[model samples]
Every structure is written in structure tokens, then in C-alpha cells.
Target: MRINVNQTQCGFVMKNGCYEKMIFAGTYHYPACMGYKVIIEEMRGRVGFKEVPLKVLKEDAAFMSRVTMVEVPEGQLGILYINHAASAVVTDREAAYWNVWEPCELRFIDMREPVMDRNVEKNLLRLIAQQYYKKIEILPGEMGLLYQDNILTDELGPGTYYYWLYARDVLCRIVDLKMKELEISGQEILTADRVGIRLNLTATYRIADPKRLVETIKGVENQLYTRIQLIVREYVGRYRLDEILEQKEAISGFLAQRMREEQEQYCVEVQTIGIKDIILPGEIRDIMNTVLIAEKRAQANVITRREEVASTRSLLNTAKLMDENKTLYKLKELECLERICTQVGNISVAGSGTLIQQLRELMGT
Candidate 1:
């Protein structure tokens, strides 16, 4: 049998349907004698190869080359072929005939879903634009991490980047750089005065360095959340219930300051930290209400006593003015007589047979 491999093609040597070795472009002859039955055929054609690229093996950060042929030794080299890690292997005749080429253990990642563009691009625009070749869009509020052969090569910012598609196993990971808000609700905390309170806090943060944020901090959101919660608990524990009640803003400020200082090490920028609510226990709330009512009643009593004192002083002054002034006293008596006459009805006066004369006698006139 005679076999040939061209410059644009690669061949695989198989014995009774089992892979033996890979062959580059060349001519070979195998005698159709003995048990040396060898079969060589092209692995793939140009069309399918282009669609599923046979990229170059990654070596270093600056080295990337797309070769027409590559050798797969006996379990020495591996590759990310067609979105999955695979290794070429030669199986026995029976296994190969039964199609028993399987992939090894694979580490899968949760890749980002592609966001399709909504606008319709004209044919000419699409052809002339990078869409025809390769287009990777790092959307607004997102950061991209570029990886070559599962090793981080660079971090890309929000924008469009084009790379050689068939040159290497290239992947772009999108990390959201927008402000993240975390709310820890109903956290029971103890105060310095031995009061137990339920606290709720809202913390907003954004990624400062995407690379460091991923490399240094595992579970970035959860880390920030736990840090904030601890700071709140510690700071609140140092203050009494009354102090905390009166200084909620100060507590938030303290928490923000502490988080700002520590979060830098984790590549996070804490934006706004706020205490959403400071919930007192049911019994504490009742007691506080009772205290408040007692304070208000005391204040009201003081005000009432002050008014009474003022009224008594005013009455004493009026009485003294009437006693010192005779004409004023007689006018006051006449005013009293006028009031009495208006109030009383059907009155009879004896002696002088006049109500005014009887009233004057009654008053010792």
C-alpha cells in the first residue's frame, strides 16, 4: 500500500482501525505482506479544519504560531480541541473498531454567554468590519480576562478587541465592574450595655483591580460581605445602646472607614456604607416607649405648675390694686352688682322696695 500527505494536509497511521502515530506531509509505502497491515488517511479536510481550528500549542506569552501539522505522542501532549480538552490515544484493534477514543478528566468553567447585537449590520459593513474576521466585545461595566491555554495572559478593559482566532486557544472572561450592593439583614448584635439588637446594613462596592480581585479574593462578594459584617459587629459592640441609637451615622462612618482601609488589599473599593435599620428587641422597644411617656408627663407637669404660679401672681396683683385704690374698689363692686343683676331673675327687694337699695344695705353701704 502507498500513502501520501500534502503540505495542506496531515495523515494518521492506523493499524486495524487503531491509531498508531501521526504523519506529516510525505509519501510512504507499506508492503501488503505479513501482519504489518497499516492504513494512513487524512485526519480532516480544509473546510472542517477551518471551522474547528487546529491552533498552535501554547508555549510562552509572546509565542504563538499556527502550524499545519503537529505530533501527538503517546500521552505526552494535550490540547483544548473544539471547546474541550482532549488527548490523542491509540487503542487496540477491537477498541478502535468499536470507537473507544475518550477524553480524560476535564475541568469545566462557567463561560459567559454571548450577548448578540441587536442592530442589523449591512452586508458591506459586516464584511468590512471585524465581524467578518474576529470580534470580541467587552461591554460597559465589564472587564475581560484573556487566557491563553488556561493561563492568564492579560486583563482587558471595556471595549472591542480582535485576536487571531486560529493561532491559539484564546478565551476572554467577562467580570462585572459595576457597583455591587450587599445587604445583610436582621443580624443580631450585642451592645456594650448588654443590649441585643438586630441590625441591617447596605454596602456598595466595585472592583478596583479585576486581576487582583480574582486572584487574591476568592468569592469577592462573599468576602466583602463577611468583612463588613464583622466590622459592624465589632464597632457596635464597643458602644452602648443609647450611644448607638444616637450615633447611627457615626457607626456607618466607622464601618466605611475600616472597610476602605482593608478592602484595598483585596482589590475592592467600598463606595457607600450605610446602616439601613437598627431594630430594638420587642421588650426593649416597650421599655423605651414607657420611658419616653414618663419623660413627657414630667415635662407637662412642670409646665402646668409654672402656669399656675403665674396665674396666682396675677390674681394677687389685681387684689392688691383694688385694695389700694378706693375708686377702683367701688368700680369693682359696681361691676360685681351688674354681673349679679344680669345673672339673677325674678328678685324682690324689701325696706326701700328697690333691688339696688337692698343690695347696698346687704353690702353694708
Candidate 2:
């Protein structure tokens, strides 16, 4: 007997009750007079019960030139192929060939486990993503919120996530988890002493709970900013101008304490709060400068007057001592005469006979 198969077909032959191994397309001649059993199976990409071909094919078997083929791309789930003859699942960029003898069904599933949005997978069988893939992009030191149908579901941190698109009707909200600053500048407030002052404040904060952030709090940044501003006003409003200027550190501490108490409610934590500046009114500043200068000048004048009085009192005591003691009076007179003699460059008496006696007489007079 002889059998022929085309290149498009694979054949299995059973001879003498011993089933032969799987064979490919070709022609084979076997000895006659021996019992010959033949089974021809078609490789169709389908899953079902397939009937076996019993008739022994000589040269009359149909030849197929092309076969059905299915391919699965990388990063994709198993590809399911089924028909009336066979069923299979292929994984990881696999290529499969099936006979065209029957109808074949082919399907590719994503291994990412996201099937809620078919549109997302439709555009990307490999690396390319579709537009329907709602993106939750959180930069480093950032937090993200995932919501499905208006309900908060998951909190994400610092990475690109397909969860927003993988699930159906999901929405994403991103919050800055890094430290951020808020400023309140040129705020005109009235102190307890009825002084009008301009207060400038700065605050730094970061998000703590991303999941409860959107659900429990609204406008977290703005809310925190307003809280700081209000706290500043309250603290500064209670103190006088002098206290506010001198006790800026205390005011900052007060604000921080308030934020600490209320931070958890807003899902944010305050790193620091400070008074950038405490600006007085133009007239108040000029008055303060003038008063400071006048007070300092008064203190200097008092010191000068005290020193002069001390010197004059000391001179009076020395004069009293000289008057009471004759010896001291004589010595002081002699000292004055010595100072006078040194002032004159030359002292030449015309009558050189008794210069010392004449000088003594003049001194006595």
C-alpha cells in the first residue's frame, strides 16, 4: 500500500494493530498482504471531539498548501485556540499552526490581569498602550488616590499605575507628599493694644493620608493654608505690638501647636510655621526710632554730668586740705613757681648781684 500527504498536512499511520508515531506530509509504501490500519487527523486550531478518518488513503487524499496560524505577543496572557479537534493555551509570544480543515477560534488575554477595560488592551498587545488606559502618574515623593465609581479604593505611591485604566470607571487624584510651602503676605491685623501691624507668615506641610485625603478633606492645600493664616491672625491678634515684635518665636510656637492639634483632621502634617516679618506702620516706626535715640542721648548726658561732679568735688577736697595744712600750702606755692620758671626760656637779672634773694622777695610779695 502507498499513502501521500501534502506539505500542509501531518498524518499518523497505524499498521498491524501497532499505532505508528506521528508522521508528516510524504508518501510511504508498505508491504501488502499484512493488515493495514490508517488514521488521518487534521491539525485544526479548535477544541472539540474530532472524528477519525478510517478509509485508507492511496493517492486520493486532499492536499493543503497553507495552514491556520495564531500568534501570542509578549507580556500577554495565554492565547486560547480551540476547534472541533483540539484545544490549547499558548503563553509568552508563541506562534501556533493549525490545519484549515475546520473552524478555529483564537483569543489573546493580557497577563496583567486587567480586563475591565478591553479598550486598554486592544491598543497594546505588546508594549504600546491605548488612550482609554487612564493613567495615575505620581512622581517621586508624591501620593496618588484611586477611585472607582466615585468611591475611594486604593492609595498609590510614586509610580506609574495602570490600575486607573485596568478597572472600570475609575478616577485618580494626585497629592503632593513632599514638603510644600504656603505664604501669607502683607496681612494687616489689629493687635490687642489697638496697634495696626502687617504680618507675613510662612508654613510648610505635606500629605499624610492619600486615601482619606480626597474623601475626608477637600482642597487640602488651600485648607491647610487657610488654617495657618487663621491661626496666625488669632495668635497675633491677642498680643500687643511690642509682644509681637519681641516674641515672634513664641507666636510661631503657638501656631505650630495649633497645627499639630488639628493636622490629623485634614490628613496633612505641618513641618514648620514661622513669622517671616512683622512690619509696623510708617508713623509707628518713625516714632519708635525717635524715642530710642532720645532715650540713649539722655543716658549719655547723665553719665557725663556724674563724672564732672565727681571731678569738681575731688578738687574742692584738695583745696580744703591745702588751706588747713600750712606745709601743704607752701609746697603747692613752690610747685606753681617751678611750673612758671620752666615756662620762661631765659631769666637774666641785670643786677646779677643777688638774683636768688630778689626772686625770694618777689615771691614773698
Candidate 3:
């Protein structure tokens, strides 16, 4: 029988299904009486010496020199590097690769400990199967709570973390520690005056005690929202619509103080409470506009009447002064004549009577 192998492949010759020699690219002829056969395999990737055991192949210096052997014992992991770049994660007990194909190196990671080695490149974990390991990343302004098998294991700060998944069921809960806004949008409630008003409430808060918040509070946001709603209702129910509108700042202050008092219970710090908007019903708004217009008109009328009364008093005083002083009266007549002259284009002061009599006629005209 004549067998051929390509340059990128190698062949194994078996004599009567017994031990055989590894052959490279070439042609060879053997007698059929010898029961010779060849098995060809591509040697560009991982080496697969299926026809012969590794112990037997290791004895062949040529075969051993052409390949690299990676032994990954139990409770250990192997990271295979091809040409100085991470290529694959090896979890099996042993693996072999062709050294002639590419430069290969193996790095062993001890799995006896669940925590990943700090020296190991975290990016290399991408090559690992998700079922074999767990990864957690807590960002800035966030905290991570690590749990194993439904039990609290550790509280983790903001950073990347890894664990062996086979040891336990890993779970991480991230809680944001930054300031957050809780907006209760458009809550309709009745005031003491039985006036229905919609209020948009906003509260700024932050997680003060993350551990307590995680252990004690199931739903912190929902509970805090309910508390704020009740507080608003309680305070608003005691005030009339006019009072609420007038004392908006005072109401906000009271609510903030009340929330602060209960901060420990919710494991949150209440920063500020604000009445974002006080929306009145359409009918009430219209009625308020009407009242505002009427009030403004009344005030304007009062101001007008006050100015009129002042003018009349001043006129009476001026009349009394003019009656007592003839000169003052004459001066007043001249002032009136000057005003009348400004209005007329020409004044015909007929050589008639005195100038005062002429001015008096002009004033009458």
C-alpha cells in the first residue's frame, strides 16, 4: 500500500493495529501482507495523537520536540498562550498543542482557592467559560453585596471581582450610593377647605447605610415614597388652599424635617424636600383669577380716590391762602394765564380792561 501526507498534516502508521511511527509529509510503500495502514491528521492546531498514547509518543524525541504538553491537574486551570497572546482556557486534565504550528505557552491557575489571583489579567477571563467562573463589577458611587448560596458572604466596594462558580452560587447586588431624586408626580389631595389640589413633590436623598438598607428594607424607594405621600397628606389636610399656597416654603421645610427624622428607619439621608408644583383645579384657578382681578380693581379705585381727596384738600388750602393774600391771588392768575397761552396759537389782549380781566375772559373761553 502506498500512502501520502501533505506538509501541513502528519500520518501515523499502524502495523496490524499495533504501535506505529509518526510520519510527516511524504509517500511510502509497504507490502499488503504486513497489514500496514496510515491515519492522517491536520497538525495546524491542537495536536491529537489518537492512534498512540502520550506516554508512548513522548518517547519519540521528534514528536515530542514538535509539540508542547500541558498538564492541568484537578482543582487547577490552564491558560494557553499562542505567540505570547492569550488564546484559550484549558479546564481539562491535560492538553497538547503543536509547537511547530505556533509558539505556545501554558500558565496554570490554582483553583483550590475561589478568589482569583490579582496578578492574573482580568481580561483573560473572557476566554473562560461562564459556567466555570463568576464575575462582578461595582462601579464608582456604587456598592456590591456578595452572596453565596443565598447567604451573605461579603460586602464589596467599587471594583471588579471574580469567583469560582463551582464552589457556590454567586450573586451580587449593586446599590447606588449617589444622591438620587425621588419624585412623586402629581398627587391629588384635599385640603382643609375641601379644595382638591395636585401637588408634585420632589425629595433628594442618598443611601446612608447600605448594609441596613439591604438587610432590612425590601423596597426602599417604594416605602420612602409612601411615607412622603402620607406626610404630605397629613400636613396638607390641616391647611386651606390659600394657606398652602401662602406657606409653600414652610410646608417644604416641615416635610424635609419630617423625612430627616425617619431617615434612620429607611437607611437614607434626606437632603431636601421641595414642592415642585402646586396645580389647582381648573374651576378653582378660574375663580382665583376672578377674585384677583376684583381685588386689584378695588385697590386701584381706592388709590384713585385717595389721590382725588389729596388734590381737593390741597386746592382748599390754596384757596384759603389766596383769599388771605392778594399778591398770591395775582400770582395764581398769572400762572393760569401762562397755561392758557400755551394752549392757544395767539392771544388777542384787546386794549380792553386790565390784563387780569383779559386773562379771566381767556380762562372762561
**Which candidate number has the best lDDT?**
3
How far off is residue 175 in model 3, in Å?
A: 0.9
How do the residues 1-365 of candidate 3 rate in per-residue lDDT, one tens digit apiece? 88788888887778897666888989888666889877888875587757767787778877787888889888778899888999988886766788876789999887667677788787887888888788899999999988888788899998888888766688888999999999998898899989999999999999999988888899999999999999998888899999999999999999999999989999999999999999999999999999999999999999999999999999999999999999999889878878888998986766657875966774775
Q: What TM-score fits each model?
A: 0.56, 0.54, 0.83
What digit string (tens of lDDT, one per residue) describes model 2 on residues 293-365? Answer: 9999999999999999999999999999999999999889888888988899877666565887777675674
C-alpha positional error of residue 116 in candidate 3 after TM-score superposition, expressed in Å: 1.7
Q: What number of backbone clashes does candidate 2 have, counting pairs of residues 3 or more apart or in separate chains?
A: 7
Question: lDDT scores for all predictions?
Answer: 0.63, 0.68, 0.87
Query: Candidate 2: which pairs clash?
Result: 43-99, 46-82, 46-83, 46-86, 47-82, 47-83, 77-111
| Location of the lowest summed lDDT over 10 successive residues in candidate 1 | 91-100
lDDT winner between 1 and 3, please give it. Answer: 3
Backbone clashes in model 1, listed as residue pairs: none
- The order by descending lDDT is 3, 2, 1
Please tell me which model should have the higher TM-score, number 1 or number 3. 3
Sorted on TM-score, best first, the list reads: 3, 1, 2
